[model samples]
Target chain A: MSIKLTIMDEMARVAREHGKILAPLDDDLALLDCGLDSLGIAVLVARLEDKLGLDPFTTAEEVQFPVTVGDFVKAYEHGAH
Target chain B: MSTALTDAQPLRARLTGATADAVFFDRAARVRVADLVCRTSLCGGRADLGGRAVLLVTASQLTAALALIELDGMVRRLLILPPDVDPDHLGALIAGAEIDAVVTDGTLPPQLAGLPVRVVCTPGIVPLAEPPRACERTEWVLLTSGTTGVPKMVAHSVAGLTAALAPSASAEPVVWGTFYDIRRYGGLQIFLRAVLGGASLVLSSAGEPVAEHLARLARHGVTHLSGTPSHWRRALMSPEIGRIAPRYVRLSGEIADQAILDALRAAFPRADIGHAYASTEAGVVFAVDDGRAGFPARFLNGARNGVEIKIVDGCLRIRSPGAALRYVGGAKTAALHDGDGFVDSGDMVERQGDRYVFVGRQGGIINVGGLKVHPEEVEAVINRHPRVRMSLVRAKRSPFTGALVVADIVLTAPAAAAGNEAELRDDILKLCRGALPRHKVPAAISFVPALAVAATGKLARRGV
Candidate 1:
């Protein structure tokens, strides 16, 4: 499965658990500006790392933190590769 | 009798004659009290800082700072400056306090060089002069952690400060260990208690790695260990944690969460794990020994263990002899205290069944890994950016650091028109990096539509 799809699935799972309804994933949408709070972001990251086996957010030294869904997906893709 | 005459006894008088050989071991060297006293006296006399403020720059050498503190009445005041203090901040502190001399183990930093003050090195022997008159007015000025902007200077009389401490329960001498800088309040309390109890302290160097420091504590057979919960958390992560077996373990400087407390108890089954509620303003408050997270709620409105704990409007208020007399440099203590003289501890608490647990700061201060960071202070800096309209700073839960700093910003109309959030975030981060300390800088920045203000007409602080 692609990193983008995996991240969307994790976000969906987190939103479901938190009872938060997430809008459909879009590249330009800011992740934080969405329904996901910091806790939700953390949970999504953890779950994605479990399924996809890489977390660029934690591993990269001088990471420019992802602001949008596209950047978030790209970070995981870069780490996995 | 006059207060000065009654309280002006030499600090050395507290030490027993038989314990003259008790050692203070640091990473560099070990020195006995007998030798340290003689050397400090010599250095004190030659420096000739007769009744003037002297800045004692300490660099992980607890004994050296202790020796200078032992010269209680010889100097007017001793401002204990930590090694990692920002040079600009140090200069401001010195100038604000009107420091006349500096006594340090090593060379003075370049920021302090141009100041018109006498510089003297410690642990050096010089020709001794007649001992200076014992002035009881000698005060020890400690700098606050300065999580806000500039560190506040807190002045405490030696007599009053020592009077506030609880007497050591142990009759036999025990080896002590602490993860606090000797200059700060938590570390200073342990340092003073260990010395007065005639115990040997294995001083941990701030510059050393956690593993090496824990190894030294194990080698010294440290029986009593005190540190912040963050410190304990880091120590527990180190493999060397198993090497040291402390009989008494204390957690202070941060809220002692249950997980950390439980982990500590499991790690050292034989140790008495307890957490004490203390602040730089209000000295040592009550300590909870149930190996739990918070103190019993009954402690409120009741005097237990000779200390009074009261809850006034959901804020923890304490009245202790160890509480600081007043804030120096015209900072008002009126707002910090009530009409009845109880200090507002700035900590908000909630009753969890029979026990009271710390929720967060009522003052909107973000406690990032035991260091207090005022959100307003960070927000003020972020808002100063030309492109920024306003900012909301908050604490984010971090596994490594107890809490990490994060900021959400609202950009100005002109800047928002640029449509480059990434570049704007980087610019704000760079601006903060230059103005604030590394820890105070926001770990992550997010752009938001608007910051919410509560009905009380203040920025709503979201509790972690």
Candidate 2:
């Protein structure tokens, strides 16, 4: 799957788990950030690994910027490649 | 006079004993067993105080017996110990204090032989008499700022120490856990609470792995755990605590951050997470809700259990039921309180609502061009970053900032994925710049696999 699709799916999973409306790809992941503290990221990262063969952002540092959903997706896609 | 068995009961039994006068079992059974082993091995040739007095050198069994014997009226007087304590110093103290008899373990230096001293290895050997009259003026001395700088001998009294612990809203049996040695004030409170409140006590083994200690707590059904921020962080990092939840986690002996407190609360949702400010010189003065971490403490508004608090010179002082007494064998210093006898240990405060919050120790504040920077404030920001797991903040001599703040951090395992130390450092610095104020930002950041803590499992102030 493409990195964009993978990122979108992962964000959707987080949104579903947190019971929040999913934001657009270009929107910030504020909905997930509500519950996506460090531990939440660990869960998200694990899900990303299962869906996409390539992992995004070699470390937690890559996912540091959650300012917008698009930024998270771009970062993840860049890392997965 | 009470005999051996009565002195050996569990803390609960002891607390309930006065009313029940029932069978008592000393909770420190291991120490008693060790003493028995020693007696059997030595063929009982050691000095036996029998019913006279026992001197304790450490809070361990050998010394615990001394405490018990003195309490039970088996001994006329008791002497607790500080390791490598000088005999001449103790002799002079006893002479000045006019204490006649001293019962101790047989490990005293030769110079102490002149005094009437009995060596006791077990609490069973010491007989008990009527409890001594509550000292109208008793002092419990704490030797803090040891050797690193001019060591100050701080003195508080039995009444003062007891007065320091404000009553808690929760009456459920208090479960106490700490890495601190009972010799210090922080750990001493746990001992006192367990003994006085008849609470269950789970003593963390010295030098045990944080994972192992958390596992031990689960196995023992511990409900309350207390430690410094470093200790709690380590325990949280352990997979065991993530699975094993306690009812209460208290951070004391140092400052804490919201991130750590939030993490702990999530890990143990049923637990009430809180922190308190205490020192060897001043007993526990204030406590705040778990959410109050990273901020200055909100002092208890109304006196609880006869505890009192006041801020003097921007320093928070407390007088509680569990405060300590005066110093002995060290330079005589004034007690912790002011004229009203309220204990103040030089903790800086910020008034928040009706209650006061502790910002930092007065001497511990770092002046960056007159912009006061508390290391804990900066450290809280550093610890909030996702990459950072644990950190220590201390002031360094800097020509530019006068006293520059430095953050030494231990990155989380995932943070190490950033490739190199430089990458992690940049990430941490960037986070600090974005989250903290310009002045509060750390002047220098050092990344390490772990931060060094003291023997008592507290972050060393120097951040060595």
Best by TM-score: 1
- Report how far off residue B452 is in candidate 2 (Å): 2.2
Residue lDDT tens for model 2, B1-464: 43334213322223441212111122333323222211221114232443333344543432442253233323333444444344456655555444444444445566556656444454344322322322212234444634253344555444455555445455554555665555566766765655554455566443457777677667656766788778878776778876566677788887666778877777778888888777776567566774665343333466755666666678667676656555544355544456776767776766656544456667777776567887766787788887678888876543223455667788768455556866666668678768665556665566767777775557767622
Candidate 2 global Cα RMSD: 13.1
Which parts of model 2 are misplaced by more than 4 Å? A1-81, B1-14, B17-55, B59-118, B123-140, B145-151, B154-159, B164-175, B294-304, B319-322, B333-335, B351-357, B418-420
Residue B463's lDDT in candidate 1? 62
Instruction: Estimate, for each residue in A1-81, the C-alpha lDDT of model 1 and write its tens digit.
Output: 676777888788667655588987789999887687665676466456557877677666655678898998898887877
lDDT of 1 by residue, B72-130 (tens): 77677778886556677776687777787776666777877865565455544433344
List runs of model 1 lying over 4 Å from the truth: A1-12, A20-81, B1-3, B17-20, B37-47, B114-116, B124-133, B330-336, B363-464
Q: Cα lDDT for residue B412, model 2?
A: 69
The global Cα lDDT (0 to 1) of model 2 is 0.56
